[model samples]
Target chain A: MNHRRKVTVGGVIKYIVLVLVFIFLAGPLIWEISLAFKGPGDNVYAIPQYLIPKTPTVNNFVEAFHRVPMAHYFANTLVVVAINVLGNIIGCSMAGYAFGCLKFRGRGFAHGLFALAMLMPTEGLLVSTFLLVKSMGLTNTLFGVALPGMVGPLNVLLMTNAFAAVPKELIEAGKVDGANKWQRFVHICLPQVKGTITVVGILAFVASYNDFLWPLVALSDDSKYTLTLGLNRLQGTFYTDPRLVAAGACISLIPIIVFFAIFQRYLFEGLQAGGIKG
Target chain B: MARSVTQPQGRGDARNAPSARRHHRAIDDDGPSSWLFTIPAFFILLLFVFYPFLNTIRLSFTNSRMLIPGHWVGMENYVKLFQSDQFWTALLNSSLYVVCVVPFMLILPLILASLVAKGPKIIGFFRTTYYFPVVLSAVVIGLIWTNLLDSRGLINSIFQSLHWITTPIPFLTDRWLTLFSAMLVTIWEGLGYYMIIYLSALANIDPSLYEAAEIDGAGPIRQFFAITVPGVRSTMTLILFLSSASAFRVFSEVYVLTRGSGGVGGEDITMTMLIQREGTGLSARTGYASAISVVLLIIVGAITVIQQLIVRRGDD
Candidate 1:
């Protein structure tokens, strides 16, 4: 083929492939949104399933809200998210500061421990953690679900990368001015990595909010279930009812999507920013 | 944000010079305050991660169960797990998932990052669309896909209407299809996360490398292999290990989609699900579950070490 023809053909192929790929990616989601608006009697799985239902209603959503106590779940998740974010920010940056700025004994050993901690999968610790929580009478409480996730070693690794990016001169200047460690951290280090902090905050929020396993194991009571656990329950109970479950799924996902979009700039920047140090 | 001048000012105080020396010595003796500040984090991690990991190793030897103290079972649980078909099946299933899903998840994210990174102003919209799934937990994704794959659901409906198939396929109900179903949902959830990682790595790749490759008359595909892949090798290894680990630890999709029954032909229950089933109050096979968990830990640890060795060899 000639160059112009080949270019046009490639362009067409790219557009077509992109469009098809987009459809595949978004198809299930679009279908779920449609199912949420479906009426009670409609056979949601029936042949000729309407992409736009003949009789759209909010009944599924109403039933979902009543059955799941979504507000309570939301409240529980919010509290869990808040605590997790706070812990990550303080714990990670503090640890990161030690790793990045301070010369200390066994620092390499300590850093290796943090890396090993990141490598240890949560499943391996599940049973023992459950036992420990049960023993402490923390089971079935919000604290139990949120507590284990608070100080992730990965956060420390991430923040250390962020913290290390602060110029050595900055820390040295603070030291020369006779600033105490805490003062240096708060006044100098924190502001320099504010962007990293914001990124970590969003990531922590997303991870904690959508966390399923711990919340499921820790809180047996439906009243204290996070949105994730609530979604699981909704699916199990309404197995045959696609509309209600889809509605429930929509409710669970919308808040997160909204939050992420609001913080997209920070989220994107955070991903790249942490890697720059490497 | 003003730097504190108190310590130096005190050091310069001639009237209290001896006391100042003592104070400076005390401060020096205190050493790194960053370590002091991080004590809360260390304490919490020790109480949770380190202790629980040690406890898992200990508990694996005993028949611990809910509402009951475990008796020492020696290696019986491990032996039983070896003999059990269920344990092998779950192991195979999880390994298959890692093998199948890791490449797709890793490669697709790299492709996506490259494409979106090069695209114009509309990149954010495409990114948001792709990443929208990352916000949904596995349960929600499972529910939506389960419905869409049901016999009378959207997939069959569209197919049937278009005469693509004469009959509805049992997507989730069938064993082979169920694994793919899980993979589909998993890939959706995983893509955005790795995409973020790749985007970060991509940003760090010096543009001059690509420019140099371009001046050498290297095409896009050649440049991608030569420049982009090599540029992002470390990040790729990090993501690959993490993705593989995650694949091995899946529970939510299995729980929601099949509830450990393994779907139509008993092909869906992963190792984590098996442990979960046996550990719960209903069955209470704590020793058996603990053995399974220990094996899992060993498998993951082994794979991780192997991966590190392989990656390190390439680096050398």
Candidate 2:
């Protein structure tokens, strides 16, 4: 009877803690979402500070879209994301296939190089990269933002591991039927590793879409600004509408929310497959 | 089905067997094509990633600038960095951030992951709820928080309403509170990601161990220490190294919040912020910034190596 009472009490505590945790985690984002509907003149803080705006409207959204060329930012962002996704899929998968299936000299060395590259954070190399990109005459171009991310060491390593999981018998059988190396890869390897490629593509897309520092450094003009860069310009040093700022911020979250909503299964599966140990 | 479309390509290779065999024999049969295939990635990384890395190290020795020419200056930059007070202050500030933020990033996520792993009933809700922040860019989060923390903003209103404080607090522009504000933002943005990682790792752990522990009358807390902790040690290590490295190199939050002002009397100045100041701030001391970058690089490298060693020894 005492143990039963203890269990019930414990259950209650768990539920309370989980709810509080969710609130704390989601509070700021939810607050920003709420402010999106509030106008500039409305008191951002009314008595009791209405968590839900009473007079919600889309004017703020329209103002943001009109003031900034939202479509241009969207186009630039989409172009970069598409290129990054394609590059990451092809480059990482091809390299992953090499490391997993085909044996050659310096395989271990190449793998180690990729791992070391993964450890070198982008911040550490920002200065030289800036100069390098400048020298290439690619500064202030979308290519500047998209080029460096063309092939990621992390994706290479991830794909290598994922490719290794495909049964060697499958590849050997393809080769036994006189299929060439390219044929074996196309026929036997690519389909088996589709899940890894999809996951890597999604991750690359999200990261490229949200990246700020590199793009800010690379792209100089206001016209080429991605959504995050454009969002930075919305609030001045002082004397700006916080509600409009909040509303503008909310717009950036929509694409990510939509993407995750669509591909959540692939994201989780990829993360689990990639992060969990054999 | 899409599956059938791919099968024709597989079947085509089988149909053109003789020609495919000829093509295979014409090329070197030792699979040197594997190495050939890896060349694009190799060159791309070498030129962009590795080449820049080497150049940065070289520039650390020189008097390089953004807009002006520079020449080799030997170890002068290193000497200056060691002697400068700002260098040490920034270093101290970064270390403080890492020390304070690392534990919360690890522990909070671990606890959250455990809660979600309890059952599938609430898993969907928890996943989306936690992951929602991970979707927002750091710039967006930075902008939103800056508004909330302003003197006349929502936080002050709430505090006043609750009678917690009689007057508004300068949360962002202040010295200590500014650092705390940045820490809070970093934790919020990062918590979901680490939680997802822990959840995945927890999911991968065999459930029979938990069942065996229950049979032996082990409580949840005890089982957590004995089973769950050990199971997730590698993951915890990875997260620790990544978070600490991120903390040491923090610039975006500091930049957006304080406008690269650091703190009152420069108390909140981080090494990365100082680098930015040297490069583009009114000073535009390019050579000096490069020197600062060298020092920052050394500090980050040393910390990463130390963490890696600790993790390795613990694993052994």
Candidate 3:
């Protein structure tokens, strides 16, 4: 009885500590939201910095779109992300299916190479990647921005693991039914890993949307800038007005957050499997 | 998007003697259809990954500027790269940033994960809140923090009102403070990612072990040290290697914070940023930047090897 009482007190203390830590971790984002909604007339430099506005306005959001081609940038980012998602789905899935279910002479070797590809950081290859795009005449285009990243090593590994989790008997049954290798994969193996495919899609979506350095290097003109580069430009343009920068940042974070919430189950499963890839 | 068949829970190889033999036979009967399926990935890999990897090595030996290849410089660029003072400073700054931040990146999240593991009812809320910062773009995080710690930004605004410092401190502009601030942002953004990883590791530990410890009157801290620590030992090692690699490659955060010029007073430049400034654009020194990259890769690879040896020994 005494031990139980002690645990209750300990539990209460733990809750208080965790809640405080949570706020500290989440405070800046909340601050971004509060500051973003403030009207331009609001005195941002005033002491006792305000958390909420006396009258919140959409003027900052309006200003964010007006000062730049926010709409065109948004459309441009979507086109690139859409193309990347499509490319990774087709390419990574085909590769993952090959390695996962099919046993070939060099399956282990090819898979090992794929894993090595994932481990090797992109820093060493940036110069050639840039030169490759230029040689292909894709410099300063959205397709060029999406091309190098179209098939991720991580995505292939993810789909392979997901498909491998399917029962061996299922594939064997398809083989007995006179299905060819491709038919067995298409008819039998591919359907089971749909959740995993969604997981790969969500990962690709976030990676594509949040990508910075490559886009910065690939696209030179303002018209081709993604949302990330556009927001980056705002740091200089909105030099005096920090409120507008916060507003632009807030707007850009919305789609990814929505994707995260809607596909959370797939995301968590992918994250669990992700530790192995790491 | 297509649902062909649904298997039951806990699906794995169903052991039937007849089917097991047939499975092996079927695998042998399939020609090289597997390679056909892999061709898409291979085509992209040839153009993007493998070619680029080999090209980077070749580029280090030539004085190629922009896109055109030039005469072979052999060891000239490598010699200059080693002799450059700026390269050494960037390397030192990167080493300092890693040393200062990687420990916190692993341990702080671990402590938070243990906290998250304790509460059942509110676990979902805390988990989401902690992960919020990680999903955000580095540009957003860099901008937000740059503003937060700016001279007239949120931190200084509060400081002035409280009568702390009459003059706003230079958080982003100062030489030392600038590098320190970059680490601060990196650590802050990294916490959520590692916390979630640790939380998953914590979930795999047997709950009965803790219940048994409680039966013998072990406190939470003791249980954490004795049970939780040992259980997640592999995860800690994994994070240590990963965070070190990322810290060495730190680029976008510094890029946005410094407004895409070089680092503040050139003191906050990391290996990736140094490579970018030297290797890209019309005046690019392809050979010099490639030499720097080779050095960076060698360092990262050495750490990985050392880490593997240490992990293997620890396992034994």
Question: Could you say which candidate leads in TM-score?
Answer: 3
> What is every candidate's C-alpha DockQ against the true complex, given to 2 decimals?
0.35, 0.34, 0.49
Residue pairs in candidate 1 whose N, alpha carbon or C atoms collide under 3 angstroms: A45-B152
Q: Which run of 10 residues does model 2 chain A get worst, by summed lDDT? A: A269-278
Q: Candidate 2's residue-wise lDDT over A62-159, tens digit each?
A: 88777777668878888888888898888888887887667666666677687678667676677777778888998878888898988877777767
lDDT against the true structure, per candidate, is 0.74, 0.74, 0.79
| Lowest-sum lDDT 10-residue window in model 1 chain A | A269-278
Q: In terms of TM-score, how similar is model 1 to the real structure?
A: 0.88
Tell me the deviation in Å of residue A107 in model 2: 1.3
The regions of model 3 sitting more than 4 angstroms off are A1-7, A275-278, B1-28, B310-316
Per-residue lDDT for B1-316 in model 1, tens only? 3312111111012112222223223233226554786686787788888998888787778877777777888887787788988888889889988998899977988978776766545666677677666666777778887887777878888899999999888788887788878888788777877787787678879999989988999977798899999988877887777688778878877667774366766668888887776765534766667678888888888878877776667656
DockQ of 3: 0.49
Model 3 pairs whose backbones collide: none
Off by over 4 Å in 1: A1-7, A40-43, A269-278, B1-33, B204-236, B259-261, B264-266, B314-316
Report the C-alpha lDDT of model 3 over A1-278, residue by residue, as the tens digit.
23433457778888788788787778888888888988756777778788887668999999988997778998999999998889888888899888777776667667767766776778778888898999999999999999988888877877776666678898899878888887887888877888767767777777788889888888889999999999998888445588888888888988877877887656655554452123
- lDDT of prediction 3: 0.79
Prediction-by-prediction clash tally: 1, 0, 0
Candidate 1 chain B minimal-lDDT segment of 10 residues: B6-15
